[model samples]
Target: MLGAMSIDLVDLVYRFRKEEKEQHQRIEGVYWVTDLTRCPLKRTYEFKYPELTAKDVFSPVFIMGDLAHRGVESLIKEFFLDAASVEVEGSREVSLPNGRKVIVRGRADAIIDLGDNSKVGVEVKTARADLGIPQQHHIDQVRIYNWLFSLSYSILFYVTPDRVTQFEVRDSVDEEEIIERITSTTYPRYPWECSYCPFSVLCPHKKAHDDRHR
Candidate 1:
């Protein structure tokens, strides 16, 4: 029974991640709104070496996050009714710094209609630590969602082991900034990104801590 359970669990997680990957599959020439949040070079690597980066491994952290997101969405639906929508799909087309146009797509966790011709985008994130409750990448992601959905404001909600908190992002990035960000190749956008990145092994620009200073 243990063996069977293990197989079932593995299969279930794999299928779930596979479906998610397909849903957010990368287009050859287009950019995802998430591209602006992470290391731009990671996306470039994904495009350049699809085979190497395509597989999704089992992760307990990701599974926890998925469950939390589903729970929160369910609660929002129950409480907010028609005023809130979950997994809201949105996209925008912007010209890159190189003069080429591309589509930037993203799905916001939830959007709440204020009934005043204004909407608020919500981005739910699950984290292990409360140290950086509102990480930069998460802030950027919510801002991009605001830009994509033309939302008046965005809320970055974090569910950590210690607490549940949220922050507001009122200002969104413009097309020019988005273009510049998407076109940049800076790897490991944050100093801590490489440690959590799947492509760190093969990434030449992976950031490493200076042990000498330690």
Candidate 2:
């Protein structure tokens, strides 16, 4: 007789997340496209205090979002004839307000070749709610992707519990705007961001929202 085998699901998730992070370790002083979408100070903290800013990669919400992105990428590969690329890496050099130059890099979700030499980028996101289907941060992310990849346009795809939808992002930001976002510490780019930030406890700029004011 054999005893029942038990699987440590938590351990498995942790390993998966660790492997992903290891493969995509951030470079020192290089800003990522995703950074432009979040509180600039958050990035500073992540690099400044690596130990304190370390996150539990095994988080279920984060895992679910990664899984959703993978599923969508698979669907694009299967259905889209012109889906020529996935995880397209791009980088651009921009000078900061202080005249110092830095590299901003990003990996687009996917790229679709129109067969006429034109291509479009894609950015996939998953959320728990459908409200504000096209989030400003997400839009900014895709727009920056377009600029990085030199694509005239890109699609912002969202997967939510209630609905699956996407929006077109044709406008792109200039180098000056990217530099501003990278250097600004205005903090909590979105009102609801602090509530979910892992470093909120250590962040001086964390928004203190009063329920009574709402």
Global lDDT of each candidate: 0.81, 0.81
Among all windows of 10 consecutive residues in model 2, the one with the lowest summed lDDT is: 205-214
Give per-model TM-scores.
Answer: 0.88, 0.87
lDDT of 1 by residue, 83-178 (tens): 999999877888766677788888888999988789998888997778756777788888788788999999988899898998999988888888
Supply the global lDDT for candidate 2.
Answer: 0.81
Q: Against the correct fold, how does model 2 do in TM-score?
A: 0.87
lDDT tens digits, residue span 1-214, model 2:
5469887877887888888788877687689998889987778777777665447575678889888878888888888855558878888888776778899999988999876666898888888788867888888988888778888699988888899888999999888788888887677887778877778878777887642321
Superposition TM-score, candidate 1 onto the true structure: 0.88
Q: After superposition, which runs of candidate 1 have C-alpha atoms over 4 Å from their true positions?
A: 1-10, 51-57, 210-214
Which sections of candidate 2 miss by over 4 Å? 1-12, 210-214
